[model samples]
Target chain A: MTKKNSEAWKKKYEESGLRDADFSSISGRLLEPLYTWEDLAGSDPETRLGWPGDYPYTRGVHPSMYRGKLWTMRQFAGMGTPDQTNERYRFLLDKGQTGLSVAFDNPTLYGLDSDHPLAAGEVGKTGVAVDTLADMERLFAGIPLDRVSTSMTINAPAAWIFAMFLANAENHGIPFARLQGTLQNDILKEYIAQKEWIFPPEPHLRLITDLMVFCRDHVPQWNTISISGYHIREAGSTAAQELAFTLADGFCYVEHALKAGMDIDEFAPRLSFFFNSHLDFFEEIAKLRAARRIWARHMKKRYKAKSPRSWLCRFHVQTAGCSLTAQQPEINVVRTALEALAGVLGGCQSLHTNSMDEALALPSEKAVEIALRTQQINAFESGVATVIDPLGGSYYVERLTRDLEEEAERYFKRIDALGGVVRAIEQGFFQREITRAAYEYQMGLSRRKKILVGVNEFVNTGRRLEIPVLEIDESIERDQIRRLAEIKERRDNQAVRGRLEALRKAAAGSENLIPPLLEAARVHAALGEISEALVKVFGEYREQPFY
Target chain B: MAEQRIKVIIAKPGLDGHDRGAKVVARALVEAGMEVVYLGLQQTPESIVRAAVEEDADVVGISILSGAHMTHFRRIKELMDGQGLGDRLLTGGGIIPTKDQAKLKEIGVEKVFGPGDDLQEIIDYIRHWRAAQAR
Candidate 1:
């Protein structure tokens, strides 16, 4: 009966005269014209999907999902000097943003002070520059450290930046136990995709393990690492690759932490994930579902974690920045809404919607407000969050979820054969895969196989959309450098030297680097100085150009 | 005599790690049968200029997405002129704004590409510039 019904539908589909276009998912997965029970053949829903908040959580991580608590609307915002970024943070908080996700400047991300030579043109270009704990203090001035949750997007210098945050909170009289936030301390993805690393993989992993251990004991509420696939997807990976590579990186961290003699349940609960909500709606949804299932199963069966909290795979999602167009940029609002919706339906714990003007420049206040309002409308107006796992039982989504799980398992086996994530990275495996995928996507665009509205298709060659882009003044760099120099002159140079020497000594020994880092932060030691001391012990990493 | 193939040096200046565009454009240049040299990430202006002079390349294309195009382009152009490679074309692409692109042109940057630009258009621009220089 099922076969006969499928045959009849296929006959009608053939005669329907649909447009001759690619009907595949963005990840190039071919989809049938219709899906039915036969698509989910031999797969028991109880074992494959299970209940929400149960073992192998594919429906959703929580029993209540968003019905209990809505996802945090955290817009990643930072620019110019610390004072300026502080004002922006205040503005976001005043405008009802639930959380603060800091976007550090490139120099800061590279562990460079504003006065460094390589930091000449990049002082405050991409995000805010925090040269020292003084800068961090000013960045969070007037903000309640005990109340609001902050997420810092720094990797290589994560320990240093995070130490500064802890020191600043201490100065504000907030204990480490009361602090709540997350740090993007995922260095594996940095090596694989983001290309922002200061040390080799071994030393980098050591820093991460130290941070994880420190946060687990000192700051129990803090999320030590947000294992990210956002950069992997932004670097031009398919949905399945992003899913597989990200989960593989997460598993590598778990394995490393377990090897460090730490209990699995102790650190696993603090491990969160960040993923890119790209243009593929159902594909992204399926990938997120598969991620939760894979992570839960691994934690329970593979790693032998006893706690249910350790089995939960909570994640944050950001709409794809690569999907925004430079041409009629306002149309990006529509694109972001759909992607953000997919993230919501995929059961993200937090969401960040990309601004329309991001393709041209940093988003202006108006543009950012519109982007945040998109989320507000989705939460308040749209009925998606009212129900848990709205698309859980759909045959198409279920089939896609299983397919993505198998795809990720295959990648896991391949990575294991290559001796794991770091070895695969050194062998240029991930780089080659991403390059091939990026090139293919670009080729598809050039060949007119893919249609990007207002870019490749629906060309607006006759006119241009005039949108306001937030401009960072040239004086921002000068002012930031001046501030750093002033702090250096006023601070006790003797104490700075002593702290940095202690840090260097600790780096050479088997000690947690966070204590020394926090000491240096307390002395107002510059980020560059601390980083240099560590880089002396842990050499630098250089990548071979793969194109 | 066989025509000289256009040689281009594609470099990423500054500390931004968004190299997907740079690598894609570099691969496209190679497929277009041009002699291309790709200088990977964390490149300084001096290093980029030195490579350009050493490669004796006719075109230097940079990709900057960290909003540092103004400082980078100005400094690189200045170094290129000071090093006596002023006649070579300097072009690039990124998330650069229209006004910044105009200012870049005033500093002798040939063109600045943005998202959604066709690869064929960039290839044609380089070939046409080389043809003009030859004339």
Candidate 2:
């Protein structure tokens, strides 16, 4: 566009009486109201975007994309007893859901058992309670282990839970090579955002590397670490911060494995990602596209990864829970649908659309069904999946994608200068950035600078929330405790003690910890017991006040 | 003579990992000229009360987003009363329903804030509660 035309456009916008706003992306980056080819001026599309399934996979990781296979509709569901969550899993799968994402309860996430004092009233409240191999078996009861892919959103005790899963699979006669799933084993994000960490960073990395090596040899189809930005975003980080911090964490893992004398190609292909699909339509899409480009480029160039599979940044997208509001909860459906669509358009391999009522409580069955149906409609009816990188080469998308890439590159340099992610996390850099961003966003809402439907605007104070909010019966904790007590009574006490002692010894020295952890799980060692054994050696991590 | 600042112990008293609300509230309290001691995640009620007693806090704010508010708050209230600290204000804010919040208030919780409750209003409530306690 000519300078005169641009000036005329600006004058027209000004004279139209539209209020001057921040015009920024949710990350506080100023967004141009319009974009032209001049924005992407000298960039060559062939070299930058290229075709799908190629190096620097900006467009997509798959050549055929969704035309070959629709993105997996994995709804993250769990609550109440193991039987209840098992029923929900079968229900979701019966409704044509392709995969299962397990959301463990708070106790499980913190490596505590349902019978622990701190677990009072919390057992099976947030998600399924799996304290031992028996609970894990019941959690997936009747679900064919080999036929389905399961993603466990457990971090701190991921290895323990993973061992329990493997034990459960072995009981079902499924080979380790046949097991396919992702572990939210990204403990760095725990330190930075989720705060579910047990041991300090160094030992946590040790546990993660053990899982990585074990999975690389045994569970070849498994994604050992889904380096996640989902919690980072839920902790109120901006899109750029989420992208940069997540990739930086991924780089740290790769560097760790390399230092341990592992080939990049052997494990890089199994390293997956989980990202948040937020409400900003263009920005979220751009973030995903930029994420793929950043991962592929860095893997091929920086890490010198040799294989094409190693360069893929395969990810699962969950529609942002932080964007869902407690007020006028139903409209969250629209928000989720749009975000899921962005995920599909941005070429996500799988997606989990959150329930509308999640901001209030654990999702009711009806709410979860609606969430699953949101993805169903997007994939089958929206006609969006038939095309690969449908938004490729669009002026705004390309410009924003490139801009986000550049911003993330800048963050990478800063993080490297801060001595990488672990040091940055210990120094509370990530926490500080996210806290400031969250505060600024809250301030924007209060100042009327941001318009959230049914919140601070549209004025829905009178409307009652009509949807059912699932309430966990307190009996769930009682039942879980009783079951745990039974397991403790019935299990071979000598064997359990022996295995736990072995695990503690393994933790004390430099050993691959998963084998001992698996042995403990095989002997009916509780999750909390395994975590405590390690805690005895590594101690617990307590964060200093950052705000 | 030195003026005393209101000491508020902000804590997460459950296995819940969400601390965005707690941190934001702590920062607001600090900016409002209160001495805020933030006890980070996975804190049990015993530990929280211990911190409250050790810190000599005028108020204890427990932030729970894990839907365990009823059990946690009741246990904490009982523990605080058992420890002869019933005069202190015990309050919190998160995903608690209005009806449950009212029940908690009836059960000895001083105030239970929910979503979109004004930050200034929280500041004012804490200050007013401390002033009333001073009397």
Candidate 3:
């Protein structure tokens, strides 16, 4: 045998008495004693890890990130009727929440009002129901339009929901450019995990692009879309799968925008991301850093985005809802804190921490406050923000970051081979991956390979533990229906019909639907009208039923 | 007969998109060796009942976290009574308190399961109830 081959084999044998080929999770991953020049041999770590507020911002997007402005602590809060939900909104703001993330009721989500036949018994249950401008006004009663940035978590009828917010803000006399925040306007991930989509992909992508163009030209400060990975993770995926699939989805959207005769720089800068803070500590942190670096390189080299903002990957994070356990519910607070820290260390611009009582129901006021406070404690007490990418130079972290990026890039090739993400989704690639990952997680727990503190391992008291679960006021249904009845009675039915007619015409044309929906919203046209108008142009998307 | 398998249609009858619990219960029911059909998120009472009638399922199980469980369950029960399904066992599970559980039963729901409920126990209850219906 050659002398060089003999020496390599001898070294590996001495280390573990086995070949170095028998590792899975962290192998092609470089583990270092300390990340030095030797660790970054083939890669220019500095050019890749550029300064905050510079081109290819792998460090962060802003120069004085938290030192200038602490990350926006936007808690995901909603439930019941608009009035009740509005009260919660005011409460959250009073407690120092900088932004608003509204969760819509099931009826509102499905484009039905409280009194709709299909909406029976379901209104104001999952989230606040807003049938018309009246409920939207009640939802933002005391809150000023020009001040707090609002993020609406709607997908199927996102354009309508966004139009409602815009109409409300305009009525409040706030101009368009003054608005800030995001709409989960991401319809692609709907096909992946959430399953709340209204129209099919072609029309849905058109709707998403419509918002992007409208927001780019009009609502400059507003984020048009937040390409989401949080739902993908919550639906059951490993940290790596979540990272890969989410970035893949983002890439697909970028490509779609480019194909639509739109410049990448025009829409790409305003595009943001949403990720989940799962329980895996360092792994989650590495995933975020890798996301930024990979996105930066891809945007600059592939898409030719000249602006640094276009390259910088900024995201909002919510703690993993699936991580919370129904058993020993109080432990969720500790879990949320750890995941929030992961988000911060990973450099999220805005974050929503899940409540301890979330496994039970929509968070009660106190439960939500605890959730917001988890972020507060992490920001103030933890001192994690004192240093930029505090875990950036760590040997294990860098190694894992490279390893995950490589794993994700492999998925990117498979996606490209399948034509693109939309085709891949149609072929059930993502669905299958998430299904397999979910099974693996459950199997791990079943075999005790993974540990859920209070669930599989810890012996808990069989007795019931009491905590306050939020109850939607029973009057909400009657109240919402009454409001809708009042709207139906009060509003100009003919004008609403004409505006909706305009919307239908616009939907058929290659025109943006937001402006027309906003016009419809001005006349207090119900969400149903706006959604059905779009539905007229774009038929509903049906999934291959899993169950 | 080994056992006349109790077939149940488990559904989330509102916009509550959270389905982890519903899915786990569906899996558990299948493991407990019963015929179960799960209608995913955003199902309405009318839609669920239609599915129940179409499937000819004996029991209807609902999982709601959207806090509209009280009103939602009431509508389901009312629909069933209207359709002559008053004999079919209707059950629920979610973040319901004890007070609401009593209220739910008053509205004619057979049982309410909250977090930490034993899937095996629910499976046995279904079997026992179905056998009693036969007798």
Candidate 4:
């Protein structure tokens, strides 16, 4: 009877003649006019999607999900000097932000001090600059490290920054066991998508494995690596590419750590993922769902992770920065709200909503507040957090979830065929794929296949909307350099020199570099100095520039 | 005689790794039948100007989203002037604000494109500049 009704509806639908439009997801997946039980085929929900908090956690990671506790509202914040960013963090915390996510400036991200020549105009510009433990101290002055969980978006120099963070926490008399935070130390994605790196892949993976082992032994509560697809999507990869590449990187890390002799259950629990919640609502949700299921299956069967914690794939989501338009900037608030909702519906552990004016500048205080409030409204008023996997049983969502998993699986096989993630990265496979996708996306916008509202369609040609852009004071650079100079004058230079020498020795040998790094941070060694020591040993990485 | 295609060099200055805009614009310029050289990422103002002089490019375009555009543009424009490449157009795009765009113009940047701008608009701008220069 259902088949007969579906046939009749299809006949009627053809006769009715739908409007001419690109009826496809933003990722270019064609949409069906209607979905039915037949789309699910012989897949049993009992195995494919068990109960929430159970095996193959497709429904949700936790049984209670957001009912017991809501997702952490962690907004990625930083600008200007450490003191200024501290004020912003204080403001955010006071405004009911649950977690702190640090955004370091490009110089700091590249392991350079604020006073470095390449760091001239970039000092305290895009994000906060921390050159030493003193700067890290000022960055978290009022905020107690023990109380709130922090997430630092530092890769390449993640070890240095994280060591500085630990040194700061130790000065605050906070025990490492009590501290909770995350390091965005996923280096593989940096080479493939973000294009930020210091050392080559082999040495970089070694640093990551060392950190994983260190975190397992010491900072047990801290998430060591946020295997990120956020930048992959931001770099203009399709949703499936993001899913596939991110998981592939995650599995590679697991393989590396396993080879390094760390037990799967020991560090895998703290292995977190970060995804970009793009404009496509259902697609984003399905991607997140499929991510949890795939990770869980691989951890249990393939890797043989004994602990259930190892199988759980916890992730943080940020609203797609690429989706925000410069024209009609106010509409970005609407875009961010919808994207944030997708993150919630898709089961993100933490969320960072991009400010409306981010497409213009970093984001003024006013703009950031509104972005934070958007999450508050969703959590409290929208009633979305009241249920776990609300769209789980829906045929359309399930079909998409299954389809995304299959697509990601196909990519995994391809990546495996190309040796592995690092090898593929060396071969420029990921870069070529992403550049192709990014080019195609632009072509779509130009050809009118994709509509970006104010950009391609809604025509806002009268005058540009003058939203308040957060301007970093020019003097911050001079002030930051002076502060660094002062620290250099005050610090025990002999101790710093000794510590850096030890770090270089450790980097040269197969010894874990974190203990020596932490020792260097304790002596108030400059980030650039320590990085120079390591750079002498590991050497630098220069990309082939595929695009 | 074969008409000369407008020569354009698109480079990303500073440490900002966001290259979606740079790559897209480069591809668009190539698609528009322009002679294009893409200096991928982490380029300094000196390197950009040096490349522009060596290539004898008609236009030197930079894509900067690191909020260091003010310093980069000023330095690149200065270097271009010093290197005797002052006649060439210095144009680029990224997440640049209106006021900064105005400031950049006063400092001799031809034009700064932002989000939602038509690819053809940029293509036309380059073509028109080349045509006017020939006149």
Weakest ten-residue segment in model 4 chain A by summed lDDT: A538-547
Prediction 3 TM-score vs. true: 0.89
Residues A100-205 of candidate 1: C-alpha lDDT, one tens digit per residue: 9999999999999998988888888889999998999999999998999999999999999999999999999999999999999999999889988999999889
Say which docking band candidate 2 falls in.
Answer: medium
Native-contact recovery for every candidate?
A: 0.77, 0.62, 0.36, 0.62
Q: Give each model's whole-structure lDDT.
A: 0.93, 0.90, 0.80, 0.92
Chain B TM-score in candidate 4, rounded to 2 decimals? 0.97
Fraction of the native A-B contacts that model 2 recovers: 0.62
Regions more than 4 Å wrong, model 4: none
Give me candidate 1's TM-score against the actual structure. Answer: 0.99
Return the top candidate by DockQ. 1
Residue pairs in collision within model 1: none
Instruction: Give DockQ for candidates 1 onward, in order.
Output: 0.84, 0.62, 0.36, 0.75
What tens digits encode model 1's per-residue C-alpha lDDT throughout B1-135? 877999999989889899999999999998998989999998989999999999999999999999989989999999999999999999999999998988987889958999989888899999999889999
TM-score of chain B of each: 0.98, 0.95, 0.95, 0.97
Error of 2 at A254 (Å): 0.2
Task: Write candidate 2's Cα lDDT for A1-547 as tens digits.
Answer: 5878978988997788856566887778888878987788899999899899887889899888999989999999898888999999999999999999999999999999898888888889889999899988898999988989999999999999999999989888999999888998999999989989898899999888888999988999999999999999988899999999999999999999999889999999999999999988999999999999999999999999999999999999999998888888899999999999999998999999998988778889899999999999999898998889999999999999999899899999999999999999988999999999888887777677877888778866666666777878888889989999999999999999999999899888888988998899998999999888889999988888656
Model 2 residue A427 distance off true place after TM-score fit, in angstroms: 1.0
Better of 1 and 3 by TM-score: 1
